[model samples]
Target chain A: MNIEWLSFLTVTLVTLIGSLSLVALYSFAVRLKAIAEDEVRGAGLAKSGAVVCFVLCGCLVLLGIYLIVPQLGGSGGH
Target chain B: MDLTLIVVLVIALALFFDFTNGFHDTANAMATPIATGAIKPKTAVALAAVLNLVGAFLSTEVATTISGGLINEGDNGFSIGPEIIFAGLMGAVVWNMLTWLLGLPSSSSHALFGGLIGAAIAGAGFSVVNYGTVISKVLLPALLAPLIAGLAAYLCTKLAYWVTKRPSGLSSPKRGGFRVGQVFSSSLVALAHGTNDAQKTMGVITLALVASGLQESGSHVHFWVIAACALAIALGTYVGGWRIIATMGTGLTEVKPAQGFSAEASTAAAILASSHLGFALSTTQVASGSVIGSGLGRKGASVQWRTAGKIATGWLFTLPAAAVVGALAATLTYFGNVGLVLVAVIGFGVVLLIWWLSRKDIIGPHNGVSDVDEAGGAISIPTKKQRRKMRKRQREAERAEAERMARELKKAQKNKKKEANGKTKVPTASGSKSRAQEASAPKREARGTKEKR
Candidate 1:
């Protein structure tokens, strides 16, 4: 069967790119944690909330990336 | 079977699956209330069952998702005709019954979804699979909904306590206001379940109809589909899923009436909101989260992490497992009539095996309730007072045992001092040294050893 190899490959690339965002954000989280720890003025809640927001935003971005990824938007076969 | 007759049978089977979905999830809406003695189990389920039927009529958006989102027309058209849909429904329904029997809150949504995927694949080819739709509509919801619900529950529970620093009087209400709240909340969740869940089957059947040329494209769900699904679900609810209910109500969280009301209310609001937005959010997840939140509401109560862990594991596996099964089933169907026969055989065997396994450690019919019509929980059965008495007796037993141990510890310390030297050495030269060592040993600090380490 002749497949739309380009379309499928594009989807794979998009997925890979989308996955990279997670890695970058994870590093950001580590840095945020270090910063939060260094600053003693904030409540534990604020520190935790900041960490949560970072993670939540990262995930939402990941979802957005997956959804908007050009080739991944459609079922290649159908 | 005649082709048309076979098709009708399949529709009936779809309704049957929808019904099982209703009953299996009844506990999802009302388990905490039942567990807390906030509402009688029978009454809670009865109200839920009625509301679910009414909820089914509330919207068509989720139905459209089922019909159009997952399965495509033409190349990605539904491969399973009525017979295939029937068989798929049977697979899902059998799975539902088995899980209910075992008292496991296996997602009926996934089961039905699995059945369709399996059967469709069996009937068609890899080309028929709508990967995008599967991931976006089904898989994403399956993964995130429960976690979101759990976190929401956790936060909500924390918020409840934070709002009321000391709500000691919450337990003893001057009136039965909490119970009244629980009844209303539970009913709302049941309605939401019906609106979001039952429509799935309707969508599948509609897809099958369009695919088979029995109905035109984009045909609306018929009145018959609605009625059949409603009735089937009501019947399923009536039969009950006692075991799963017990786990949600008591095992995961020690539910109190106020907590139960909060959970049911929260679950209802979340579920209704999700359905309105066309998210086929798992009722189980929403309900479980609400219960976990309730647990949090009652200060000092910790969620049973182990049970939650098991449930998390189940959720993780559900989609991929179903996909594999669907793929295999599809491959077999490619082989035609002979393959269909084998599919039937395997389906029967797998279902029977699951059912047999459920009976292994079954929760009894009483299902952790003692009395039916009693003022609170199974009368003559364990009520709050009885549970408190039992707990008090256990605590006393524990205290006596603890005191005996304390005496023994004191005696042992005295003996050690006698055995060693000079006024119970404090395991250090002086108080500062011992305190220094004690402070350094975090492990020993966790235990907070009364005796110097």
Candidate 2:
């Protein structure tokens, strides 16, 4: 109900959204991987997309960790 | 400083409860993954253990809610003492062990809440508990979390199938992909579990610290409290809850890779959302519901509804059972020093009894998976009648097999004797001796096994 509570709530929301996006990117990466073996002209495009999504997913998880960390949240995280 | 001893005891009890909580709920995160063979059971737990340790440090909002919001610990002059908390913890831990013995994934959070409520009501009267917070933060979420997670998982499962579907309506390649995806999704659930479930103990410990006047009201969890709690939970997680895992993984429904992925993802989302909202819901209920929903989502998949019903019954009983024990413990403690010692002694006895009884029907890797499905999710040592019947049937089969082998050996001997006698007036001693040995070998082997049995 106060600023501290509000900030915690905000952090929770951010992390929730972040997790969902990571899953979505994972799904995209899987699709790209499925087609990476294709010999078609689009194979290059698929490979790049897969790499980008995997990288993004990894970054999202790290960001989530950073956001949840009390030390990184300046001391009012409770 | 008379309270110092009691405060340390309470903190130790809180950490013990946290350890039980970790193992009890490991099924929530890793059950589906283990069931689907996305990861080996041992490896899955190790992964979950590390993630839970990390997740425990994620947020303290729920911990604050527990310490300050649920039980009346501040200004109303009705401070909950360490003695009451200790009794409550004993209540919670006993219920946890009972449910685990039955392989039921009941809510540890509910047990804790119920124990505290009962203890508080007994010690300080009903006015000491903040009923509004219990209703909104605990009860409402308890009722809603499973339903929401179930619905989400059901829809997500359908989506998974649809996206991966071919003209034949089967997604074989996609199945392999999802099995790999299950590792990630389930790990997320494990991390989410640590963030949510471990905090309940932190909150309880913090509450006890406040009651003993060791910490200020409205303060964050102490660093040592966080570290100890995280370690307790992580170590417990590493040990794994194979009984509950067996029940959730194979007893409730047959989990495929896609279903596993969907269920894990849905569970992670619901738990994370609840944790963020500061709702102390049971992750077990959410995970169980998600699994059931996924089962129903897939076409032609059958749910062991009887097992599901039993689990539901356990969930309904969890709160009241813990509360009753809590109340009794609280009443015992009311008699002062002797009563406190008596409660601890009785609690220790009960814990040893449960553990001793559980050893009779150990659910290790060999028998854990196979026994659960047929027993409707709750596997204990087979009853005397059932075990006797099994033994009788096994003996009958072995006897029948041995008799058949004996008959075959006799027939072969007869044929050899006729052939030998037909060839010469007197059979060679060496040939007859070799034949006798060959004929006796199989019979001897069969006799040896029968005697062993």
Candidate 3:
């Protein structure tokens, strides 16, 4: 394969890898949150774990943009 | 060796740096839940692992900071060769393991930075070091990031409660909207993990390029570097980071779901925002802030101020401490190939020794170390404070059960009397005598929960 093609392939692989991770993280967050009501006890801990996942989600969304679109400006006005 | 071969090898070593990073810093993301038992240990780690992997592909801002800003990379000036890259990665990786073995959450980003700085200084001279960038990009953020995140967490947590104050039942969810809110916030943290922590590896790979003369100085990060960094870090996250998870989950804060949510949300926002702006802040520090903030956010959370003090002191000393060690190792490498060989042997031996020593304590997810730590300290000479809390909680639960039983017994007697009068309405009174004898149901439940505790 051409060197350019190899590099493209690599980037594609990384994107897929990232996508899979996001799926896993989202599933964990949702499942963990669902279970908190019954199996998990603490009200405070369950809520926090959930939001922590949300933070992770937002970060992932941002990351998706960062990967798909390279030149987006910072959200915080620079 | 050929330059290309050396380059590949150095990149692999940088990946080794990343794997340790995932393991060492997993606690920063997942500790709050594991400590509070919002998620089981296995589930908590598994979640953190995947999120961290996804987070690595989020951005390359951190990479640019390291490759272009932190170090000077030019031929005949201050470039990091494959050899220096190898040595630097080794230094960073070693420090990560050392801290993990001790169960301290030091900055993996700082360790790598220090190693790279040490290697650059060794390869060329102090002139190649960009102190300004180090201060503004790395150090200043190190100082302020956690504080900002923590303070924000405190304020947001307070505000979250204030906003929710008028609601009827505490954490009652009344409608279950908060569950949806939680999913949103936790995902942000995981994504922030990808965007920020993963970028550090990208920087390392880019730095290796400059060092090995594979890329021109001041060049943008090549796609290969980005891919390699992403792949390595993602793989590392998949493997999981159990030791640091234990420490962070329990050691830093008494995390409840509300506080954990606030802290993690605060941390994710702080880290990703900073990363995008090209500030290479440590996620550990950001997470620490959120945890502390969560403590302040809750009306009365056990902040363990003493433990926070130790962690703060650790943060203060991590960069310089790792820098000193990195410099020492780099200096040793200069004593020719013999020095390199000796350092390698000695370093590996010492790292293995530390690992072995850590196993003696074996504070991990499987052992219910949280119960041991919260119940006491390090399996011996347990904290009197924890013991007191346990006793108090036990007493309260017992009291609550007694009240419940007394109420039940009174109602039962009333029903029994009414039945004799033939105006009975409490039809479930068929087992009144049995229930009176088995009023210990409440007590048994209390005991069961206590057993779990």
C-alpha lDDT of all candidate models, in order? 0.56, 0.74, 0.62
- Model 2: per-residue Cα lDDT over B392-449, one tens digit each: 8767866776677677667667776777678653455456557657756765675675
True contacts kept of each: 0.00, 0.11, 0.00
Q: Which is the better candidate, 1 or 2, if ranked by lDDT?
A: 2
* Model 3 TM-score, all chains together: 0.66
How does residue B114 of candidate 2 score in lDDT?
Answer: 86
TM-score of chain B of each: 0.71, 0.77, 0.72
lDDT score at residue B48, model 2, on the 0-100 scale: 91
DockQ values, each candidate: 0.02, 0.11, 0.04
- Candidate 3's C-alpha runs over 4 A off are A1-78, B1-5, B33-47, B73-80, B167-183, B241-253, B300-305, B359-361, B364-453
List iRMS (one decimal) for every candidate. Answer: 15.8, 5.1, 13.7
Model 1 Cα lDDT, one tens digit per residue, B196-305 = 78778778777667766777777677777767677777777766655445554334334544445555545555555455445565677656655654455453343456
Mark the 10 consecutive residues where model 3 chain A has the least summed lDDT.
Answer: A1-10
Clash counts per candidate, in order, are 10, 0, 43
- For residue B25, model 2's alpha carbon misses the true position, in angstroms, by 2.3
Arranged by DockQ, best first = 2, 3, 1
Q: Weakest 10 consecutive residues, lDDT, candidate 1 chain B? A: B370-379
Spell out the clash pairs found in candidate 1: B19-B232, B19-B233, B23-B237, B118-B326, B121-B330, B122-B329, B122-B330, B370-B378, B371-B378, B371-B379
